[model samples]
Target chain A: MPKAPAGTLYRGREGMWSWVAHRITGVLVFFFLFAHVLDTALIRVSPTSYDKVIGTYKNPIVNVMEVGLVAAVVYHALNGIRIMLIDFWEKGPRYQKQMLYVELALFVILVVPDAYFSLEHTVRTIFGST
Target chain B: MTATVDGAGRPVIEAPRSRAPRPGRARARSNFELYAWVFMRVSGLALIVLVFGHLFIMNVLDGGVQRINWGFVAGRYASPFWRLWDLTMLLLAELHGTNGLRTVINDYAERPQSRFWLKMMLYTSAFLVVTLGTLVIFTFDPNISG
Candidate 1:
């Protein structure tokens, strides 16, 4: 058996890295969902309690984190479509590299405006504009 | 088995690789994995719409999270449409996330015991979150005093 091969389609390439990012972001989003459910459950406890907990989310730091969360979700959503196409579409695997580039382009196009809108309040808060 | 002489005059044994089973001879098994695969794609398509709409309404519109309060939540849950929307999003997102985490655990957890326990924990949390979220959506009292 040969000790090593010249190259591979997945190893250290766009496919592998995108898969890695998907897992990381998926985990991040899942954990956030768990906490979000708990916090939302506080509404049943009392309006005061729910508002108190939600108030923490209005802080500049947390707002920035929300931007990160949005970025993660957006990437996951777009890449998820890419993955489905790879599985279902006949020519998807043949052009997976091209699809990944398209996915990234769409991700940027979607997330830029989302990040700006999500962080606008944070910016205003930090710069004493509001 | 057939033997042939190589270039060095050594006898080479022929090893026949296992052939794929014929259609009727194929081993029977549950289609759980196949269903899970299909579910991921279907639920994912729905989630793209549900979750994006949710994020847009909650975090991007009307001054974003800064304006969200109990009143806003109450106002939303007052409508059956928003309640159903939230309920559907909650269920699908949780199930999708739980399945994703399950795949992650299966991939990374090297030991059987650790894998079992990790999945157990994941399922337990998923159950709790889904139950709690669903209950909150349905039983939410928008007019509660105090």
Candidate 2:
């Protein structure tokens, strides 16, 4: 058997990178939903359980994690659209790389403001100012 | 999308190689890919609305997370409106993400055994979550015994 190359994951063109990112983000979002549904289901047990669970999410660490979730979600959604276009549009496959660039651009644009707001909220909540 | 053998007896130019399933796997109907492809697009568009609306309602509007409590949840689910909304979002998002992961696994997993097991685990967990979530949404009882 041939030995695998080092940095194999990093060695990819734009489309490959986007494919990797989409898969990673997709997995992250899936796990997030898993946790989210479990937590939300706490409501069925009792409101107290639900509120207490949600209360745990107000800390600094969890708040930062939320920002990361936001980033993952933003990228996944944008790249998902890119994938859709590539599959559906007649001209899409030919310009897959260009579409990836556009997706990345939009990802940065949306995630930056979202991260900012998420952090701002985190700070306020941590300080008990809000 | 035909393959031809070279002078050395190696098959050449398997043009449909990318779309073909791994060896030993049953070939899917050609339209399956097309349907899965279309499902992603349609479900994705639906999720944008359902998910964003959920985020906005839960985290941004009317005093955000602080305002979230049993009462808040009960109030929302008290109406059929929020129940349907949450239910739709839950089902669509789960199915869409699961299908996307299925494609990822099919594309990347080198071993057929690995692919089969991975998808088995995925479908099992997805079923558990979706079922539990749906039941919770529909059968939630606001009153609890002390």
Candidate 3:
């Protein structure tokens, strides 16, 4: 009776993918934080190790990656706060889409500066102070 | 919870046996709610393990927060083993957080349009993050200026 594939419908569409992404980003941020904590712990191991860890952060590619991490944190944090509002305040689900858009707009606004600052710092760290 | 009767006097009933409308076209609770419920539970459990295991390995073990370095990462990436480990972590963690947030989205946002747009933004941002994150991890460069 249906024309499309099985996963194609009200069941497996835009909403579903978004749900998947949120969880994925959360997991990502968590892992990054874990690695970050461990990497920072390198200080006690030896100053050289610490420096190496610091040095890794200086890579341009890594700098770009940090931006991705920042985006994840920003988006997840914003959407997450939205979620809290719904759960605790009983916000209506009718506004879910609007809230999602606002959350995303805020995400871009927040992330650009955060990433810029991080990249600026990384560049400085790598090439020496400006 | 109202019912009607015809002139012939047969009582018209509402609320199907499954508490949903009818088979293949139930108007009950939108779509795939049962699956979403299951997703939340499964992803939540996986997150507990993946998240906590990561924390223990990073902050609690070894020299703790101080030993990480360039060579260390380079060393890890040197082996296919660490690469796979990292890639798996990347995929699973992102999925977990995104799923958790989706549940949140459904619960809140009273207006249908608001919910739709909010989720739209959420999905867009999530896609960008996941795409960029994967790229960075896989194509990481240890030496830029050198």
* CA-lDDT, candidates in order: 0.89, 0.81, 0.60
User: Comparing candidate 1 with candidate 3, which one achieves the higher DockQ?
Assistant: 1
Model 2 TM-score on a 0 to 1 scale: 0.78
Model 3 ranges off by over 4 Å: A1-14, A121-130, B1-146
Error of 3 at B114 (Å): 39
Error of 2 at A33 (Å): 1.0
- Cα lDDT tens digits for candidate 2, A27-59: 899988999999999988877778889986666
Candidate 3 TM-score to native: 0.43
DockQ, model 1, C-alpha based:
0.44
State the lDDT of candidate 1 residue by residue for A53-96, as single tens digits: 99989988888889899999999999999998888899999988
Q: Can you write out model 3's per-residue Cα lDDT over B22-124, one digit (the tens) per residue?
A: 6776554665766765655555555445544553453234532234455665666677776666666556655655555566666657677877887787676
Poorest stretch of ten by lDDT in candidate 2 chain B: B57-66
Top lDDT prediction, candidate number: 1
What's the TM-score of each model vs. the native?
0.85, 0.78, 0.43
For residue B27, model 1's alpha carbon misses the true position, in angstroms, by 11
